[model samples]
Target: MSELHHYLELNDPVAMVWRKGNSQDPFTDRNDLLPVINGIITLLEIPSSQHKVHIDGMVEINQELYNQTSALLPEQFLVNYANGSIQFHPQHEGATFSCKYKGKGLILYPASRIYAMVRRHPDVVKTLQEIIDEAHTKLNDTHLAMDQVEQAIREAHDASAKASMAADWASQAAANATDAAHNASHAVDSTKLLFKPAVSDMKELLRTHLNPQVGWTVQTYKDGIRYRYDGKDWVPIDIFGKNIQLVNEHTDGLMSSSEHSKLKSIPLETKERVIVFCLPSYLFQGVQNIVARFPFKGEIVGIKAICGVPGDTDSEIIIEKSMNMKDWHNIMSRPVQLDAFSHYDDGQAVVDRATVYAGDCFRLHVVKQGLNIQNVTVEMIIKI
Candidate 1:
C-alpha cells in the first residue's frame, strides 16, 4: 500500500493536524507562529518613503491614530504580508519617525502544498502531533509553577501582618513600663519627704548622708531650730511664736528689734542667686521678652548686662520688669547704657516693688538692641 494509506490507517492523525488553510512553515519560520510584538514605542530606523522596504513584520504607525488616512489602508500604503515589506504613500516620502509593531511575520504554506508533502512523507504529520502534545504538557507545568508562586506570596503577606501586630504589642508594653517607672519615681520622692532622719545640723547630716534630697529637714540642738533643705539652702522653718528672740550666728545673743527689722529689709548676701539669659547678636532687631518663675520668696536685687564683643555703637538696653506679664515698669531710673565691650550693672538697689513670693512670675522686656554686637548676656540677681 502507499505511505499515505499507511499513515491514514494509523487512527487518522492527519485530520487532527492544523485545519487552517494557510499553516505557518516551521522549517522556514520561527517555531512559534505568532509574530514577535514590539510592545514599546520606538523610532522607525528606515525612511517611510515610496520605496518598498522589508519592515520584518506588520507596521503600526502611530500617525494612523492622528490622521487615519496615513495607515495600512489600500489607498494609502501597499503591504506584502507574506514577505513583511511595505511601500509608503507617495505623499509621505522620505519621512523618518517612531513606530511600534510586531516583527517577523509568520511564514505560512498553503494547505494544498502541505497536503502534497504529507502524502510523500507521512512521518512529518506524526512529528508535528508529538510536538503539539509536548507543548501542552509544558503549558500545564507552567500553570502549576504560577500557582505555587501565588501561594508563597500569600504566606509572606500573612507573616508580615503578624510581624506588624507583634511590633504594636511591643510598643504598648514599653509605654506601660515607662508609666509604671514614672509613678514609682513620684512615690519615692513623696516617701523621701515623710521619712527624713533627725540629724543635729547640715554639716553633721551631710557628713554621713550621700543623697541630700530636697524637702528633707535637719534640726540644730543648740538653737532648737528646725531647718529644711530647700534644694539650695537650709532655710529656717516658719514657726509662729509668742516671744521669739533674734540671735546672731557667731554669738547667740539677743538682737535688737531694729537690727532684726534691718535684717528682714535686706536679705543675706549668701542667699542671693542669679538667673541668666543669653541673647544672640542676630536677635538685635526688636524687643525681646523673657519670662521666668521664682521658686522661692525673693526680691529682684540687681540687673546686669555683659557684652562679649565690642561694637562701633553703644546700646541703651531698656529693661522693664513685669509681675503680671501685662503692666510693666522700668527697673532703672534711666535706660542702662553699655559701652563697647563693657558691662552694665544696676547696683543692688531695691525698688518700690513688693517681695516676690514662690511661684510668682517675673518677666523682663528688652526694648532696644545693640548694633553689631557679638554676644549679650543679661543677668538678674534675686535675693531669697
Candidate 2:
C-alpha cells in the first residue's frame, strides 16, 4: 500500500504542492493547493475629471466615509469595465470617496479525494493498468488504419483533378457554341434590298407614299417620339407601358417585393429643420449655451458642426442638451474633432436621446472650443 501511494504521488500530473492535507484519514490526508484565490480591498480618492477615480480588483463597490458605509447607486456613477474605473456623475468632486469591493480571481476547485481512494486499492489499480494496455494496442491499430485512409485520399484527389479538367474543357466548348449561335442570330442578311433614310429624307415622303413592314419603326424629330408600324397603321410607342404604373408617389410602381423594398429605402421627405449656433469673435475654450424652443414635435435625424475658419490647432467640441434649463445630457456619443483642413464634423442622431416634443424648451451646449476658432456653426437636423 505504501509503495502504491508513492507511485501515485510520483506519477501525478504536477509534483509540487502549496498546502498539504491537515486531515489524519488516508483518503483526505494529502491535498495539493490550487492557484485560485479571492479577497477584498478598500481605496480612497478625490476625482477631478467627471468626478471619477480608478479602483483595482473592484468587482463591486460600496461608499465608505466617516464610519458610515452604503452601496453606491448605479445611476450616481458609471462603471467602465474595459479599464476597471468608475466615473461619478456631476458633483461629488473634491471629497474623500472610499470604495470597498471584492477583487477578481480564478474559480476555486477542491482537491481530488477520488485519486487518493483509487491509489489505495490494489485491485482497482490492476484493472486500470489492463485497460490502459488495451487502449495502447487499439491506438497502434488506429494509426495503421489512418495511414491506409491517407493513401486512398491521395488517389481520390488525383482522380478528382482529372475530372475537374474534363469539366472545364466541356464548359469552354459549350460557351464557344453559345457565342457562335448568338453571332448567327444577329447577322444581317445582305441579300434583301432595303433603303436607309434619315428623318429629313423621310419627311419629304408622305405617309401614303411610304412602304412600311409590320415591325418597321420610325423616329420623328418634331416630338422625338418613335412610331412603329402595326401592318395597318403607324402608332406612337409607349416605352414605359410595361415597366411603370404611376398613381401617387407612395403607391406608384408595378414592381416586385424586392423592388418595392428598395424604393421604400430611398428617403423622399425633403423637409429639414436646421438650428444654427454662431460663435462670434470667440477665442477661448469655453461652453456656449444657445437657448431655443422646439416648434414642432419630430425626431432628430443628424447633427453637423461647421466652422467657417478652422483654427491652427485641432479643435474638439461636445454638444449637450437640457430641458427646462437644468439637468443637461450629452446629445453626441463623443466629442466632435475638428482640424485646420476640415471645417465640418457630422454625427448621427441617437434616436432614444434625440426625440423632442412640441413646445419643449431646450438648450445646446457647445463646450471645449479650440484656440482661435471663430464663426463656428452647429446645425441640428430634425426629421418630421
Candidate 3:
C-alpha cells in the first residue's frame, strides 16, 4: 500500500513491518519475521563495552528457534529476542552496533512510529497511489497476454494457415543460413591465416629452386635454436629490445653418457661428450639419468648445456645415479649445492620433453657405477 518499501533509512526501525504486535499484517506469522527483524538490527549503531552485556528478566513472545544460531553468535555482539542476551566483548562492537530491544532503564524501540512518520509524507502517499494503479494495469495486461498466447497456439494447430506458417519458418531458416554462410567465410579467412606460414615456405622453396639465387644465401649456424648459423655461432642479441645483435652464444650440452663409463680422468674440454649416469631408480623408477658437461665430447645436436662454472674452478662435485634410498642421507649431508643436468638418449644429445619415465626409449640412461661419484655431481641447464 505504501509503495512496498522502495527504500529505508538507516535509523528507520523494522518493527513497523516485522515485530510482533508492532506491525499490522493480515498474513505473515511473527515467528517467520526473523529476516525483516534482523535486517533492521543489521543497522542501528550502539556503543558496546569490552565485557559481555547480558540482559535478563525478559520474555520471548515469538516462536522462532534461537538455539540453532546461538553457537554461531559473533564475538563482540549479542542479540536476544527477549528473555536474555549475552554480548561477548561488549566494548569492541563492529563498525555497526546493535540497539536495545527491551531491558531495564532501556527505552523500547519499535516500528509503529516509523510507519506513521513515513506514510504521512505527501510524496509517499502519492507514490502509494501510483503503485496501486500500476498493479491493476499489470494484472490486466498479464491476462490479455495469456489469452493472446493461447489463441496463437490454437491457430498454429489449424491447417488453413499452412502456407503462411511454412513461409514464416522458411524466412527464419534463410536468415539462419545467411548467418552460417557469413561465419563460414570468416572461418575460411582464419584457415588462410593458419596456413600462411606453410604457403610462404612453399613459395620460398619454389623461388629458391627456380631462380637459384634471387634472394638467398647459404650459411650454417650453431646447433641451437638461439643461434642462427652464418658461418660462425652468433647468439641472438636484442639491443634496446629492438635490433638483434649477432654475438657468440655459449652453451652447455650433453655429448654422451654411460652408466658404466667413468669420468675418464680428463678435463671437460677434452671430450666432446659428457660422461654421466642416469637418474636414481628410487627417485625416478625404471629411468636412466645421463648428462654431459659444456664443450661436449661429441657432435652437438638439438639443445645443449655445460657446467655453468669455469672449468678451471676448484669445486669438486659428487655425481651419482641409480640412487638407493640408503644413499639419500649421504647426498643431503654434503656441504655443496648440486648442479643442473640434461637428458641423453642412446648415444646422442637431445632434448626430450615427452618422456615421463626412465624406461622411455627416447631416454638415454646413465648412472654412476656406485651410489655416488665424488668431485662431480650433475644438474641440468636446459635451453630451448
lDDT of 3: 0.32
Cα lDDT tens digits, model 1, 1-384, are 101112243443233121122333211211112222331212222222332322221233444352655444322334343344445544444443222232322333323223312444335443454556678999999999999999999999999999899899999999999999999987765445432656654577668566666778666554456666656666777432324455654433356556756677884457787777776543243345466666788886776777677545566665555557666666555554666555553343334554667766654444544445556777777898
**Deviation in angstroms for 294 in model 2?**
0.9
Go through the candidates in order and give each one's C-alpha lDDT: 0.52, 0.50, 0.32
Query: How would you order the candidates by lDDT, starting with the best?
Result: 1, 2, 3
TM-score (C-alpha) between model 2 and the true structure = 0.28
Q: What is the lDDT of residue 87 in candidate 2?
A: 46
Judged by lDDT relative to the true structure, which candidate is superior, 1 or 3?
1
**Which residue pairs collide, candidate 2?**
none
Superposition error at 105 for model 3 (Å): 15
Separate clash counts for every candidate? 0, 0, 44
Point to the candidate with the largest lDDT.
1
Model 2 per-residue lDDT tens digits across residues 108-164: 222322222245535443344455667899999999999999999999999999989
For residue 291, model 3's alpha carbon misses the true position, in angstroms, by: 49
lDDT of 1 at 364: 45
Candidate 3 wrongly placed segments (more than 4 Å): 1-45, 51-108, 113-168, 183-187, 192-249, 252-384
What is candidate 3's lDDT per residue for 1-384, written digit by digit as tens? 211232356554432222222234222211111122322233122112221232221212222334445433332234443323333332333323323332121123433332222354354433444565678999999999999999988887776677678899989999999999999976654333111111122334344444332122322222222211122322232122222343322322232233113444444543222333333222211122343333311221232223322222122223222222222211112212222232211122333231122211122222212122122324333221
The regions of model 2 sitting more than 4 angstroms off are: 1-270, 346-352
- Considering summed lDDT, which 10 consecutive residues are worst modelled in model 1? 26-35
Each prediction's TM-score against the native?
Answer: 0.29, 0.28, 0.18
